[model samples]
Target: MAYDIKDVRTAMDPVDNQYHIVLIIILISLIIAAGISVLFTGGQGPGETLNLSGSLVEQDSTGQKEDPAETWIVRILWVDDQNRTYSFQDYPQDTKPDPKSYTFTGDPPPGAQAAMIRFLSWDGSTERTQGARYIMDPDSVTAVLNRYTLMARLSPLPTTTPVTTNTPAPSGTPIPGMLIPESGVVCRNADGSCTARFGYTSRHDHPVSLPVSDMNRFYPGEPDRGQPVVFMPGIHHDVFSVTYPGDATNLVWFLMDKQVSVGTVPRVNTSIMIEPISGYAPLEVRFSERSTGSVPNNPLAGTWNLGDGTITSITGPFYHRYEYPGRYTVSYTVSNACSQARDSGVVTVYQASYTWDTDPKNPATVRFSCTSTGDPSVWFWDFGDGYTSWEQNPVHTYQRAGTYQVGLTISGQHGKGSVVHTISVPS
Candidate 1:
């Protein structure tokens, strides 16, 4: 029988209260289950973001986006192998489908309506780039998004931090004063090949000469000869070392090979000095007075006594000046930079300038005093008594006296000097 609203109300009184309550509870539980299922199963399907890049094609021949077919709505209809359908809801980062990479974040609750995504295309940032596009699981959308965001943090803005890289400097120890040009290689073009010969400055400071092209060819690469390298000729040599002896410092320019570009002038830093130069190792001069019993006014020839560095004759400056009638001094200084040097000598003893006037009209032979610079000192003296002696200093009596001229000559490693005097005798 069809129950009217009045009858249903009447029947409700007969229904058990427990049964109705139970029914209510069961209904509520079913609803909750359904809700849970929907929440967990939900995924990206509708309202999901879409990214597309590249120029849109137009129905018209113009191929420009201005055409109606290239509009946003028209672009969303992507045709695939299956021809499935999907649409775009939002295009973030402004221009849709920009070449920029995209990432998804936190997914919707499970058991909810899912969003479907279809990748349209992507455009490259520049001519060098290859654009990309693809779809991924929306359930994992959140994690992917977080990953991209972390990466985007790295996507530098137009401005970026500058990077610093260190470059080592080109340096080496300067070559010490060159005593002579380093050994040089010279190539001899013989027949069809070349032979290299290494040569050095003279044993005793000499000049060198060679060609330039041959020098360049032989060095760095041992020439056809294979053993010798070539060198530029005419390089002034410096014997000085980069550092002094006993110096712990090792300072030298290490060339790939021995070859140095000596063509250009180089500054000198090493020092070389003449330690010592001896002209007259041991020298002596002697003057003797003739035993005429004539009684020579002055003592004859004084002993030179070169006396190792002690002899004032060449001790230094006054060397040439003093008792010069016997011997003189000579001094000099030499440097290594160049042959240029300084030297000086003066007549220390001016015997001729001295006065000698001893009287007794008659006398025998006479002598004078003087020392020479040569290994074997030679004494050439003019006695006031009209006579001369080889002895450094000699005393003599005038064989026959009248007016007499006296003089002495002395020579040494420092050069030579002489002195003379005038003597008068009367009966």
Candidate 2:
């Protein structure tokens, strides 16, 4: 029977009191069991609670208040066997006028084999990692999460002290210290691109600001490539990166009188140059490999994907002919012990041909249609008479009717080709 809400309520109300109590008890038992399952299985899965406590002491205590605009970030990181990194970070604020210590908690991801802590300082635009420390293990997994303490002394923020001097400082008076440009690591990206990191070390007691000029610049390209103008006093790594397609090499950063080359690490750099990228069918295209790597005299094992169901392990400065007409993507890859690089280009093959349709009533007039491929930029049409036209598709009238040979010639960046057909014109 179909029961309404009132009917269902009445049916439920007829249950005995003891049965109602038993149902309530069963529901409570099920809820308690679920809670216990979650507490054991869900809560305890794949992570650990980390209690991080640290103290920061100023290198030069000036008895002055800390800059409100400045922020310090404490990061705890660990890597698993799969080379995946897990990080826990906290931003500590100054409670007092002069900040001293900080305390916070973090949850590190599972399989954390080794743990390290890094302290960073961020002042609006720039953020720099001051230093990093690896925690010594008492045991394997359990030692990473327990109560840990770190003590670090931070460098004083840059300040300008006024000096009373009546006479102007002599011209070319040497600056107090020097700024050395240093090249950091080269990182390979998943998209086959690479990045070279650059940084600087400031030996001065205070911060230095240099504009993008001859004193501070990058070589082989633009003078300014998003490098920092303001430098903090310390050895800061990876201040900026130069991202380019393929491997980076011979990139130099010029700071004052010092210069450093980036991407000094040994790796293969690949480039493909294809001449006459597009042409008529049975097109013979030239492919050249301009790849360079650190290993000199090392034979580069290269592979080419002709994109026409043809794959060859041929070292190029070679030729490949496309028998049919279509657009095909060509790729070349070169590899050695250091690393591998790959580049791709497109080759378009066009078939030179045309179709002509004559007017039914006016048999002397004809419309010539150019069906040639590859978007030919230049077209020449000869109507078998003395008249010629440059239009892709042209119409012509014959004064006298006879068998005539019409020709069409097309040309583009790919190359040039021509085709001719004999047609009978009626009188």
Models 1 onward score TM values of 0.18, 0.35
lDDT for 207 (candidate 2): 51
What digit string (tens of lDDT, one per residue) describes model 2 on residues 1-427? 6889997887777576769899999999999999998875546423332123322323324445444456655545444545332334333433221222332333344554335555666566555566655564534323322222111322222222222212111123124346777754565566766667776666532356777788777766777777778765445656678765554456677777577765544467889998888889888989887877644323468899989989988764888889998989999888863468899999988899999999998999999999987678999998888899999899999999999999999998668978899998998
Name the runs in model 1 displaced over 4 angstroms: 1-265, 268-376, 384-386, 399-401, 412-415
All models, RMSD in angstroms? 32.4, 28.5
Error of 1 at 76 (Å): 77
Score each candidate by Cα lDDT.
0.32, 0.65
TM-score for candidate 2, residues paired by index: 0.35
lDDT of 1 by residue, 23-47 (tens): 9999999999989977854643433
Find the candidate with the highest TM-score and give its number: 2
For lDDT, the strongest prediction is 2
